[model samples]
Target: MDISIREGILTPDTFAGLRAACGMPELETALVGRAIESSLFTLSAVNGSRTVGMVRVVGDGAFVFLIYDLLVVPLWRRRGIGSRLVEEAVSRAKLFVPPGRAVVVSLFSAEGREGFYSRLGFTELPAAGLGAGMQCFYL
Candidate 1:
């Protein structure tokens, strides 16, 4: 299959479908639309016209970027689509910072998925003397 990764062409419906296929809870269509519009970068993996994978980056556009909502349809999982999406997203996020300046690109890997990101050069926190990463989610 020829999977083509494109930027900024994701629709709410496609986003929701990809989310569902990855076992995530359904989100409101309006919320998906707003999130897509606000994301710093968004990439969708397409096989012909179907969206089989996606990833989003959110950040301040200068110093910090957090990758979020990376998902690929189950049938497509072992084919390197997720890795490609992440590589592209990180590449674009780095462009937001000026040369010689440092930028942090981070993500919270889903449980049991840390190895996937690690292979792509992400280090888990609490190593290297840094504290464990923390988060507070809205209930």
Candidate 2:
């Protein structure tokens, strides 16, 4: 219930733990470390010493910012922790742009989670005259 949002302090283990807790596939710790460190910005939700959720921002600071790897442990879902992580991540992304300029903050929402993000001000792709976003994965 007492959650604090912190910046860039996630260990690979903590990240992988949250992923597993949320039923996402695990990644190699080395790769997870690289991803965490290379993130343009990251916010983690900590309740006491445990990491309950996280969101990472990736992409060039000028043109695009992708809200990647947003995960909240099942125990903490629907308690506003995810929303706070996203709101904080987007707030940080806005800081990267200059006055009178704009930048995009994008994310690939999990299936059935679109409504959660839409309520937080994200429009689905292919709306607003933009083509639908696409992705491919390599194992």
Candidate 3:
């Protein structure tokens, strides 16, 4: 199968289609639209004219990079499309990450999702039970 991964400009139509591919019951199209328009990097995996998968990268574009919204349609799962998408994104980041600078690439994986990320070369940062603490503000 010929798969093309490209940096796609996010629009209302593209965003809606990508959101649908996510297969998440609770995802909001409005928020996704807002994010796609505002995020730093958005990627689309195209098999012919169909967008099979999508992922969003949000970060300072310097030191801290966060991977978000890595979604692959059910039909495309286990087909290596998602892995290629992640690989392409990581490759792009490597180009910009300064040598020896304090660069951090982070992602949050839900329970049972760790294995997926692990297969992609991600591992949990050790929990030393010491630090400023992991903090998140959600409404």
Candidate 4:
């Protein structure tokens, strides 16, 4: 399959569609648009005008980068499209800061997908002095 990774081209509707295709719960498109606008970077994986996958990176450019909403439609999974999206996003994240500065790239992987991120050079939390990741969702 011919897939092209486009930078900063994600639309809220496209994002909602991808989420639905991946079996994730629906989100309000207005909220999604706001989130997309706030992202430091966004990438869309397109196969002939259809968005098959996408990722959003958010955080202060110098200190942290969160890889959010990494998704590839079911039909495109395991074909390296997801991996390429992540690698490319991280590569761009690294450039956000000046030389010799380090930034933490973090992501909350989907259930059972820890090994995927691990193989991509992400260390499991609570290892090597890092604590397990935590989160708090609002009502």
Instruction: Provide TM-scores for the models.
Output: 0.94, 0.94, 0.80, 0.96
Ranking by TM-score: 4, 2, 1, 3
State candidate 1's TM-score. Answer: 0.94
> Which of 1 and 3 is ahead in TM-score?
1
Model 3, runs deviating above 4 Å:
26-30, 99-103, 127-137
Off by over 4 Å in 1: none
Better of 2 and 3 by lDDT: 2
What RMSD does model 1 have? Answer: 1.3
- The worst-scoring run of ten residues by lDDT in candidate 2 lies at 98-107
Native-to-model Cα distance after best TM-score fit, residue 7 in candidate 3, in Å: 0.6
Global local distance difference test of model 2: 0.91
lDDT of 1 by residue, 19-125 (tens): 88888899988999999999998999999988999999988898779999999999998999999999999888878888767678999999999999999999988
lDDT of each: 0.91, 0.91, 0.75, 0.93
In Å, residue 93's CA in model 3 sits off its true spot by 1.4
Report residue 107 deviation for candidate 1 (angstroms): 0.4
Which consecutive 10 residues in model 1 have the weakest lDDT in total? 94-103
